[model samples]
Target: MAALPRQQHPDLLVGLETADDAGVYRLTPEIALIQTVDFFTPIVNDPYLFGQIAAANALSDVYAMGGKPLTAMNILCVSLKMVAKETLQAILTGGMDKIHEAGALLVGGHSVEDPELKYGLSVTGIVHPDRVLANSGARMGDALILTKPLGTGILATASKGRLATPEMEAGMAEVMRTLNRIPEDILIAGHIHAATDITGFGFFGHALEMARGSQVTMTLFASRIPILAAAREFALMGLIPAGSFANRRFCERHLQTAPGIDPLILDLLSDAQTNGGLLLAAAPQAAQGIVTRFQEEGCPAAALVGEITAPGKGIIRVEA
Candidate 1:
């Protein structure tokens, strides 16, 4: 963004300015390729589970933008001397299963030897230019909706060294492995104005980006935020992760905190989500319908977390 060097092609429509879910390069006035690639090291210990989480996280970008994933190429970095082939196979199997579940074809994939294990997908999805969802269109009075409970990052951190409890691990794993497909159908049906998937950036970080990108402010109600019960209980026990701190730092300037609510709640909001759900800004009337639709689609964690407000006041306000 510093300077669009000379050879850069000018885009007639929106693309990178909004910190969108994915990069849209228009092929024509009618169609655009929504491309996104996200890869990371194992978040969980089980190779198979790690792969599933990674695949779900990677494909979420396309879904967030109201695009259906059509095809994908597997990306793998394996440590040949460091791990057994069986472990790698489990990882691949996990990813393949998720890709199939998403209705996206895993036509081919690439694997290379490396010092650390990494796996994800480089996905391509198709969408009509006119039907694409964007983050810049969020309006005042729009109710903010979150489709998944927060705090996956906290559990994952505790999951390391067997520090995580059975209930805690089960809850985070369940949410992280769950796909955000429920919201995609909602987006395609039209009415959703702005949307973004939560990942390493945490909810507040991404919400701030949407607000700043749209030149608006978001007022979040802490009491109503749908967070896994374990997230709060464990957070008080100092089960916070390194990424949580990073997330807090990233959104600290744009966030407004209140007392009586333990500071641990911020840790929950800033918790680095792996394959977190969608945070949508849409008309107030649509909020209840969207939440209900998500419940019908098996995402009971979805809820109306807050509302978008006017600009210059603040990007986010976390109630007491």
Candidate 2:
């Protein structure tokens, strides 16, 4: 995309340049529009639950950009012959449930017959022009907070291998279904310097993006990082997905691990995520307050996992 020449407009606040979660266009001095779209093949067995996860994942980009989702349009690709009519209806119904939960209207949708089943949404949201948050403004000494535990990628892989237990599958589903709406709204008005959702690229990958984009190094406390319950166990059992290994390789050259740090833990850190939570870089003075409020508002898993360091080689230090 960087090599491609595209016309630029002053009203376009964010486009492909920064690799931001969404496209932000300033409609007026007070209001900006956030647009993002995402869809993927079913990760869970139940079509309804799969729809819910896909919708949540799609809406997450808007939340990561500190925008209030106002509406969404469905994007579906299904194998009509292989899927029952009720299953398709259930999928749309599930997505509608989440759209409503986000207080967004389901305006319309598009569908196509395909060999594989898939679903998601194209979400449009609104945010104050002055409050638009990007993943590139993190500063030195800023504290990093992760609002959800990692491990969905590993658990999902385990499910395909028939290694994940029913409890574990349920847990992963619950995490994916939950939106980042709470933290996004709560911290957007706070001292947050930068933010990004931990999704396909994983925590380490996205954090690396933050650091590199801000021209700073980061030190993450391995012990302080939150992991999904049973995620480590699944990872230890070698249930990691192909994407996880790819993530590790993609970011390894830019990472520095302390001596004796467990390899398994590193693998979990690089584990690709689906519908993960927000990773916020907050000013030190406001970090604790924001975290306290997030937890008090029912986001108990939220934690201060790391901090930004002075500009350097964009290396991420993992300290045990």
Candidate 3:
């Protein structure tokens, strides 16, 4: 995309320049549209669960931009000869359930027959023109909060290798299918400076983007970072995904780790996530409260993980 000619327009509030979660376009003086699309092959065994996770992941980009999803269209690729009709229906039904849960309509969609099975959504959302949050607005001294535990990639690897127990598989699925929506009142009260959802790019990979975009340095507290139960164990057992290694390599030049920092923890931090949580940069005074509210509202893993230290060229400093 960087090699292609870019399109320019006055109403294109957020576009290719910043690598933001979604594109925002002004529709009127008071409203802007948030649009994003995401799709992936099955990460979990259950087709219904995979559909739910895929839709949730796509819809999260809008929420990261402080917008509410209004409509969604499915994107599916599957082999009619290989996949059962009942399985296909279950996947569509699963996606629809999440769309309805988000108070969004599944108006239409397009599908094509393919050898590999894949599914996701194209979502459109709305936000007030002035209230749009971009990942580049994080201010120095802002408290960073991560809303979900990490390690989905490792868990998925374990499942594929037949090393994960049934209980572990269920737990991983629950994390992936959970939506990243924060209540309007909570967002308004927190005074968020910036936000982005953690997805294919591992936690540090996304954090580097935020740091670079905001022109600020992030000092992360490694001990405070949330990790899913068994993620560390699996990672230690060499269950890390290839994407994790790629993410770490991409960010290593700008990453600073304190002496004695646990390699295992670093592995977890670099784990590629699917349908992960929001990484919010909130006003220092309100950050703890935001975490509390998120926990009370069913995000049990939400916590204050770090803070913006100073203006810098997208450097991240990790302390144990």
The candidate that wins on TM-score is 3
Q: Tens digit of lDDT per residue, candidate 1, span 1-320?
A: 62653333544245555568787767788787888888889887779888888888888898887788889899998879998989988988998899999898898988898998899999998777877777677888999999999988777766775777777777787788787885566666677888889887899888887888778878889988898876676688887878788989989988877667677778889988898989988889878999999878868889999888676544787885
Off by over 4 Å in 3: none
lDDT of 2: 0.89
TM values, all candidates: 0.92, 0.96, 0.98
Residue pairs with backbone atoms closer than 3 Å in model 2 (clashes): none
- Compose the digit string of candidate 2's lDDT tens values, residues 53-84: 99999999998888899999999998889999
Give the TM-score comparing model 1 with the true structure, all chains together.
0.92
Error of model 3, residue 186, in angstroms: 2.5
RMSD of each candidate relative to the true structure: 2.2, 1.4, 1.0
Instruction: Give the lowest summed-lDDT range of ten residues in model 3.
Output: 182-191
Q: Candidate 3: lDDT over CA atoms?
A: 0.92
Clashes within 3 Å, all models in order: 0, 0, 0
What is the C-alpha lDDT profile of model 3 across 32-63, one tens digit per residue?
Answer: 99999999999988989988999999999999
**Candidate 1: segments with Cα more than 4 A from true spot:** 1-14, 182-185
Top model by lDDT, which number? 3
